[model samples]
Target: MRFVLKHPEQADVEKIESLDSVKGTFTQAGQFQVIIGNDVDLFYNDFADVSGIEGTSKETVKDLAKSNQNALQRLMSNLAEIFSPLIPALITGGLILGFRNILEGVQIQMLGQKIVDGALAFTQNGAPIYNTIVDVSQFWSGVNHFLWLIGEAIFHFLPVGITWSITRKMGTTQILGIVLGITLVSPQLMNAYGVAGAESINTWNFGFAEVQMIGYQAQVLPAMMAGFVLVYLERFFKKVIPNAVSMVFVPLLSIIPAVLVAHVILGPIGWTIGAWISDVVYAGLTSQLRVLFAAIFGFFYSPLVITGLHHMTNAIDLQLTADFGGTLLWPMIAFSNIAQGSAVLGIYLLHRGDKKEEQVSIPAIISAYLGVTEPAMFGINMKYRYPFIAAMIGSSIAAVVSVGLGLMANSIGVGGLPGFLSFNADRWLLFGLIALIAMVVPATLTYMYGKRVEGNE
Candidate 1:
């Protein structure tokens, strides 16, 4: 008997293998293969296939089970494992960033116009630079300010959202976690970004110690770790606290101290780490060695996405944009995304004669181009290695050109065609040229020389 179990647990595999009749075992795409000389009974349900007798005809069922059971679990277990939980927040944040980019562009255009007008007046009137400007409010009207605020709010409270997601994953009380998260990013707390200058002056006396009330707005690591720590605290409290008073004391004691510790310690430490990374990435990528830097990043960025380490780049991107006028590294990411999608499209072209292969490649191609590369990466490119290499070459070329042209986005997160909205208006044409190159190069190379394989199914 040869059977494939759809959702294979280690326990189930062990049990099947323990049987005297079992001869061999293998696993792939969420399937566990058990080969025996004769029919053997297995406790587990959802047999994907038994000697090519499929469980169902639906691809969705197969794909969903495969992704949940195989890809993520087989990868790294720490930060990478949490990428699944973080997906909703990531997609939402990326979409909302488009609005932020638009508002930023409007502000830049208005400020540039005002400065030019002020300069002309100054030249004629012989006034100082400071005295030349008539009104600062004219640069950003009330509506613009409100729209900008709306755009910033999502990113500003991202820590809260991440904390909420993490706590849910860790089996902590969602409301308590939310409360702790919100308190960390509260409007009452001093902004973390502004804390450096205020470190000398800002002080709060809490009887036990005098500490600064720094907020954790936009912090990623601290929020995620804090949520994980809350689980143990809640579990400890459940054992000690009296049932009648447990509700009030457990929540108060568990969250208040955690929040305080996070604010005083974790928040600042995460901020420093984020800042250091931003400095390194920005300085390194913008240096005279930029062409080499671009090529290296473009080559490795897609692989980083596969391991789920790309989330680390978000902090660097956010901080770099805040410190510099705009971000220079994000264009490399966009180019890499375009290249990955183009390679998938090339695979689709090569396999057009096979309906099954085309079916697999088309959706993966669409997803890659839309700035979500996992489908294409895991589903198609990883299966046939040469397409991935072709994509890296394309990404490298595009990244070098982008860096040479000094292309940048006002914000991070957006990529692919949607990324055009995030480009600096002055460099829009250069951005387009780079994206086009990224797309065409990989497609051409993959079609000409990259290895092609039939559908994995």
Candidate 2:
């Protein structure tokens, strides 16, 4: 307000045609004027440059001037849009990771973790660094931990939180955010096991479930429930309150009330959702109908990877670590993607191109091998279409076969060479071999097929 009033004269006045402003008197040589529309025309000769402001208010200026309010408003608007999807993504990943951490003990056991005592002695230096690194990693790993917490808090606790910010109907994505974030962060909670006797030396503790299932509620469910309120709050406030005012007011009023509801109600709801999804997927993947089931999962899975929905699998893994003790999904994508990349790239290898085509093919193939889909997708698979179909067919074959092998993943992260982690040597080796086989087949096929198209002889 002060900024607008102090420099009113310096701003060149614009005379946009007056609206029905009989009461609001224009006393001067109409020293100032206001126009409300897409474009403002300054009648005065003094007006030389065009300027814009963000907020709508009646401030008289001698010349058109860009106002800080407008800049700040635009910045806030841009940030909001950028963060909307990101908030959900962050929460879903964080919660799932939290859950995965909690269930690591059971997960480690299910994968038959061993050799910890034999691998290396956890003496003072080793012990401290190991613990410190793990803890520090957790802190840095989920910088979005708090953000997702906000995401969750709004979704589960504040109906207004969810409705105010977003208009879209809540569905798998919304639920998945709660599901995944719970999966990750829930696993991080304190899990203490009650040993049977004083001399039970082998008992281990998990972060969330301390030797029991009921305790999963204590740590994992709060954030899960928090997901609902935020979703609601988003819709409610977004309409009634201006974004600037809502920024401060939303957190203060929304957070406290939503948090209260979380502790009281939403925890069990989230747990149920997480458990149900995991159960259904595991049941499908493990059935005697594995081939059909796997092909279906495989077909959609890579598409998800292509679009980034594959992050849901990350949530599933976190839940896996917590509920059933391990994960087997995503490892297939590692093979399929690599295979697609290799096969498509084989075109470049077999190419006797006009240099330019070969150049394009080589880079596309390399990017695919590196597990980036765009160069392969937008570059080759998309351009030729056949290569993509070939890659998909190859991926499905590999996926079904991987399922048949009962391949499971104990290690985390997306598909790449590093995904070969020997943490569970038997499963790792079996899956690794299977993945290698899968990739080789498709790559060979693409290479052979691509040979005809290249060099035009």
Candidate 3:
């Protein structure tokens, strides 16, 4: 970690240099720079004691944390507001998708297995028992197909739902956004997905510009963008047009321009951007740099949580699944979360004799293992210092190992124990083993550190 100190005094320079964790310090005139190679927390706490350093006071730290939260909240507020209404549908779709994947995995796993082979000799050439298992398999197979349809129905037309949601969020006419969204993905229009791939499809020139007609099924950014356009244009028309004719003219104007712009411009732009991110991430995951990629993300993930930047990974995970049928990052996040929980467990073990400490640590462990790390992180690991660092190390190791083992998740949600539902079933065992390692390594390291610090505390 590096930070600049403006107008630093001689005493301030001396104080920072005294900290052993400060790897390097440089100064030119009144400007000072310090690099902490390890123990960023120590630097933050110690440097705050310096006269000119801004964030060392308790109130400053609290305010800084709040400021970070507000910044992140504002960054995501609009998108989150739009998505909040669709959460139920998203949850339902994800659960069904997970169930379908699991059922398919079970069928594949049982393909070569023999069930009650001797029972077949006793009952009508074993047809009864064989038919029973076959029937069950077929039953699940049918159920999985239905579940797939249920999930796909929501996922395929997500653009429309999101558009409707956005319009509501923006306080605009929902009907116009809905119509724009439907027109974007309409089957009657040229297929948006396949248009670029096919050579036979021709572009339409509207005198102003030539645009290839395409649909927007399974898209999100375009729908949200069109909502923005509709909201602004609707407001404009409502302001300028007479109320007698405004209702019809506003909807008509909003629908036409919004759909046109989304289809002709924003839709393709968003698709290209999403596709580029997927390709870049895929390349990093597939290449030799993958281990480094996983380690960096895994190690820094906890810090991202503090700043609320972790939410951004959700989009990346979804895009990865869309392009590659699975996501490499979700497993890394799982390992990181598990590591934080294990670190809290370590802190708990160290304070075995103290009921108050144990009480705090116990729930933290549970919360972290449940894929919510805030309790474990702020409650125990961050407080202990060494445990947080140990957790980062453990998570980084596990992430690199996971990448090596080719562990991946089919979707992003239900991490920790329920993470199995998101995992690629073929490598479930491998994912579990890596997660276990992530837990054990951090717990052991933090426990050892805690033992040494126990009496001192």
Candidate 4:
């Protein structure tokens, strides 16, 4: 339904009417594209400036855009604010892993085989890399052999490891000092987790971790021990003086004892639990129908998105990584998100519609651009009322292809922009390509199909 305002004193009224025919949205110049499908008019009209209480054309479009512009800028700024807290620990860990990958790659090339060859060249363009490679073999050999000599001492030191974004807060000078002081010199700490180096390693595989899984600390003993320790630690720390002032001595005082305790108690115990959890999942994944099971799991994966069951995916993924050193979830999910976004882009392009139809499709397209699919999923595609079948035809095809790719994720991250990094070095390139195919093929089909349906009032 095309609207023409007849000298309407309030131009917003004409906009309000013009967008009425949309699935539930609107577009307006110099303001946030209006979403007028619901009580949007009620909320927007509440704005004193837009309300036209004493309105005039002289009021300017800027008035219509005020609140939204503020909102958009704040969202952008807040995202920037979070970068410092998040980057160091996370990216540093990834860099270390990348270094490890480089070392492994060199070692495997020496043996003339690899667990996975990222790139191999016998003839790039036409001839051999034989002499060139042989010349560099010594360089590769140095990297390969040096990795094992002091890998942990250099790489896993708490100060260094904590530099990773995930643990940046933990690595702070203050926290480090506190942790060390309690662990060392505190006799009670030495007993709970076995004391020496070898004992520490065994405790991870057998001590607290084993006790939690088995009945070593019986039902009552386990619960009671947890409580008593918490109470004692809570009280013990309450009496302590701040150590930052004692800077020179604090590191010495805090660290020697804390390292002992963290090594014995926290790291090993956490590793044990993490390892145990990993085993349970790894066992399940590699069992009877590993591929088929993976495929089936991938199939159900899409719905977790719609129902918000996506968060639980973390544990499942942790297990996968523990078992396979990485797992298929990353690529598959990335494909899912990308395919859905592509389908939304499809609507924007192929949704030949009346002005109203165009209005709805455009904003849904906007949401998809920022990586929100629900607006497209629940609002338009499903409600397009005719092409529902076509979108599924796309999604299902994408799911099957994802299963085939054997796509794997080495580390975990979130949706949207961060997820783009997930595709790095993961074998999911094929799944990503499949998503592109799924989006284009089905989008074309859906558009052609929707084109044949009725346009609008």
Cα TM-score per model: 0.73, 0.52, 0.73, 0.47
Worst 10 residues of 3 by lDDT: 126-135
- Deviating ranges (above 4 Å) for candidate 2: 1-225, 234-250, 305-311, 451-457
Clashes of 2: 67
lDDT of 2 at 401: 86
Query: Alpha carbon lDDT of residue 212, candidate 4?
Result: 17
Q: Of the candidates numbered 2 and 4, which has the greater lDDT value?
A: 2
Q: Which residue pairs show collisions in model 1?
A: none
TM-score of 3: 0.73
Better of 3 and 4 by TM-score: 3
lDDT (Cα, 0-100) at 452 in candidate 3: 79
Per-residue alpha-carbon lDDT of candidate 1 for residues 1-457, written as tens digits (9 for 90 to 100): 2233433564365565456554335443344444442244342232434444444433344444345554454333334434446555544554454454444443333333444543533435675232112235545345455554645565667677677766675567888878878987888888766766773645679899888767777666677667777767887897899999998898888897788777778776877776777778887787899888888888899888765567666656766765664688887888888899999898887767865556557777777777877657765676678889999999999988888777877667556766776664456678888889999999988887744333333
The ten-residue window of minimal lDDT in model 2 covers: 21-30
* Tens-place lDDT digits, model 4, residues 403-426: 555445554444322343444433
Model 2 per-residue lDDT tens digits across residues 1-457: 1123344556532221123211011111122223221223322211333334433333233122224235544333332332344344433443344343443312222333233545632555554213222233466446535454653443223222222223223321343344323432333432212222334333235555333222232222334346556556545655678877976764555555554455335645666787787788788778888778878776666556443445456446545545654555666666666766766666566655645455445665666655555556544565566677667777787788888877766424445444554124445567667767767776777777777665465
